[model samples]
Target: MNFNFLSPVSDSVLAHNELLSAQVLGRKLHIHSKQNGIPDLDGVSIAILGVLENRNDVNYIGEEFELNEIRKSFYALFPGSWNTIIADLGDINKGESVEDTYFALKETISVLVKKNIIPVILGGTQDLTYANYRAYDTLMPMVNLVNVDCKFDLGDSQKPIKNNSFVGKIILEEPYNLFNYATIGYQTYFNSQEEIDLMNKLYFEAYRLGQVSKDITIVEPVLRDANIVSVDLSSVKGAEVSLKQKYSPNGIDGKEICAIARYAGISNKVSSFGIYEYNPSKDDELTSMLVAQMIWYFVEGVNCRVKDDDFSNEDYYQKFITLVDEQELIFYKSLKTGRWWIEIPFLSEVNNKLKRHTLLPCMHQDYIDACNSNVPERWYKAFQKNCL
Candidate 1:
């Protein structure tokens, strides 16, 4: 039993009416209570874990866990058309130090992911994403991470890691498995010019808030390419979440964030998901319910996921090849889901951990760009990263 790594949800949090309504998810969730044992993982597709540590946040002055409030709001909501078993593993209280909490989270998430159970993390701070990424170190050869936030958070690698600088640690740390990092809804005023330039120099992708709000569907292809998704509630408008940081007056609204969450859940490559920077206050109910709805959309997306990775079987996909810059660009569209992918030629032997995949996820737009003789930057970056 990994019970040592977690604490049962407080009795007060589960004090809801026993009456089970078909709509209320609290009635159906296998919550980890003091009396009941841990839920079986046999058919479970998603596990919810609450974390109560935030010392690493750049603005940290000490904060309380929003778990109970979040729980109250989340449990009261209705589930969508989902058949997957969802379990609440309760909360991880603050450890001795920030690193101590990081250790607990890393160790805990590592085992669950190894078992192929997707963990939907209710987080303390965005810095915990470093631990989320670390959990996949030995499980996979490389990783593709997507962060939904208003800042790149690419603080100095030379300094101690904080919520704003965890990405720098992920990039410079050992067992380097990060292949791609994409940011959605980044605002120009929040990120420094150097950090912005660093993104381009490192070949990472960043979509401005206006770009995403203009075309919400554009985020799906990016999420489809990610392995881990970390979302900062600060990315949402302050009017929506009453954000602690008060970071942005302009941000993605409630609907867009949930859409992004659903897209993350729909991605076949996304193994673990996290929602961070939730600071509970007088208006906790409003923010908590919004966050809960986002989680619901993710669960709905998971239930609606369709497998389309098999390109070897000619019957499963339609192939298209276009010549651009004297090089042949190959694309595959899933016959079942209509999703798209582009082939990045692998020069080495097949089946190697690093070579398990050569096809990078793309969108229909990429094919159109290729047809117009414009080489897709994403394809080029993936090609460069793989060949090196």
Candidate 2:
């Protein structure tokens, strides 16, 4: 029998330490420890956490990727880094129970954030997002979340621990505001209208890629204020390729997908990010290579932002807003003096012309009143400011 799954670690020729000791492109890595002979990145708190094993026996596992393959790929793409990737080899299927994975994830995240490290998580399923959010609970007072997926993953969990609707349970239980969350690339077939309606009712931002394919420029401002980003690979495509989803056909492509990932990474506000639904059995070598490339670009975006920049918030806001053109879409910029006035796209009402800005933060209730009422005339006249 192929007893590679004997335990979390193996005592074979290619020891776990030997496999995980590869370097990243430009940065030096530090391997922390070798528990059970599985190599942990030393001094490198930032991580790419992959919950590949689950106790629920949910048929989520497809084919597993070789650690050597992933490590070598990372080294080729990022040559100078000492250690940027690590995997948990614990026998996730020891039983059909929740296991200590959730606790381990929570502790791991706490350690990284405390040390100012960014964690790039890969999911066994969408359930990991809930655990991730929970990890950040005490650390972040107010969090802005961006979800790029085909479905809301909000099915009723009363039946079983389904990945479908676990996020719903999380939102209902957490004090976080729905408006702070944005769901991008939603497909009509994957989600119910009721789910969509529920999202809108909760004031969550939701965008349909069916309507905005090339106009993804609008994504800039939407995420400019967000602190967390979670991605589901199913949102990209479901094909037989190594990295594609099993059920999705209509989705974004590799290059365009990377652009979006780069966007999120460059935002600098992102504390945590994830990619889900990768089946190594179904994945092509090219697909595996692309996964490594995507991870590289993610780190590239992270390194681009400087920590001590003092650019006025207005500067970033204006720059992000300028990314959207009025020629293609009729969006009115709501400008309030001495307060942040975000661009609100009246998309559903606009001749169905402009790409909708979903999950965008509207100003406070008072500002909303002003934007809705005739107060703009007084405010406009008071400040000799021109509305572009």
Candidate 3:
């Protein structure tokens, strides 16, 4: 538990916390403060951490930011009927270099993950996700990342990593822990044709902004299978956030983004969650409150989680088999939660990246599509990736 890199929460926020009702989250959380120091994480289920580094932002102009506003908004909200213990471990201030900040964040996340505690990261820039992804290098054999962003952020990995280009580094970097990467609510105009083709060529998943807005439920299965979930506040619609935080006129609305966060939290496989690219401004109250509610929904979803993925017992799930284009598709439905899963046939002969991901979380629509002799796009991509 070497959290030496972490700075305690500010005294002003603590003063604000003192005024909050005892029933609110601020009073209930195990907060790391100046007077109290770091709280013991013995029974903590989730830890809130903030990163104050933003040099990697392509638009960086030597500006500093803080998470106090977001913290204030979060603290004011009343908690739902929940049993999960949460800790506010405070912020990691910017180091001498951006890489130094990344090192510190990587170390902090690595320690938190190894303890089986989910780190709800409030980030300075989306590129911090690269550090978060790297934290999983030694912890797991393979990783699946789901980014809720408007752009793919697949910038040239050969150059310096920016907030928009970190994904490229994740894909090309060594240790090669990233097995799958998916983008939800991606706007096509923001991405180049080459990046779009590259995503398809790599057999990765990308759900369009329009498609996701039309049906947010489609993302449940994607999030369910993911190990790391990163959200860019810029993905939220311009009208839904503060002027400084707005990126696109068209994007996921506040409720939709929060729903996606809840889905990420409810997923049994999702180990680490991050909300990045927050640009605080003078009138960022709306944005701060939205971020706060998103966290609240995520914590709420975590409390509602059930062990419905265990397929060992016959009573827990029901299985179905169908044929499409001579390809046998097997589906499993959880009796406990009614969630669906489609099995990817393990290729014993090939060196597979998805050795542990044989059962792919799917939707009931996928089963219907399979029955109608159509292959689900997710299954096809995952199956192809497994073969490669």
* Global lDDT scores for all candidate models: 0.86, 0.54, 0.94
Better of 1 and 2 by lDDT: 1
* Candidate 3: tens digits of C-alpha lDDT, residues 183-287: 999999999999999999999999999899899999999999999999999999999999799887899998999999999989998888999999999998999
Q: Which ten residues in a row have the lowest lDDT in candidate 2?
A: 378-387
> Residue 90: error of model 2 in Å?
9.9
Between candidates 2 and 3, name the one with more favorable TM-score. 3
Which digits, one per residue and each the tens of the lDDT, describe model 1 over residues 1-388? 4658788877887776254465688888888888886777777789999989889877777657657877877888888778998999988888888888888888888888887789999998999999999988878888999999999988998999998999999999998888899999999999899999999888789999999999999889889889899999889987777545345679999999999999988988889999998888776777888888889999988888898988889999999999999999999999999999998886574343355547888899999999999999889877666655
Per-residue lDDT tens digits for candidate 2, residues 104-218, read 6666666666666777776566676776777777786656678888888777756565566667766767555333567788887888988888776555667787644766755
Tell me which of candidates 2 and 3 scores higher on lDDT.
3
Count of backbone clashes, every candidate in sequence: 0, 23, 0
The C-alpha stretches of model 2 lying farther than 4 A from their native spots are 1-28, 31-45, 55-68, 79-96, 157-159, 175-179, 306-388
TM-scores of the candidates are 0.95, 0.67, 0.99
Record all residue pairs in model 3 with backbone atoms less than 3 Å apart, i.e. clashing.
Answer: none
- Best-performing candidate as measured by lDDT: 3
Question: Which model is ahead, 1 or 3, in terms of TM-score?
Answer: 3
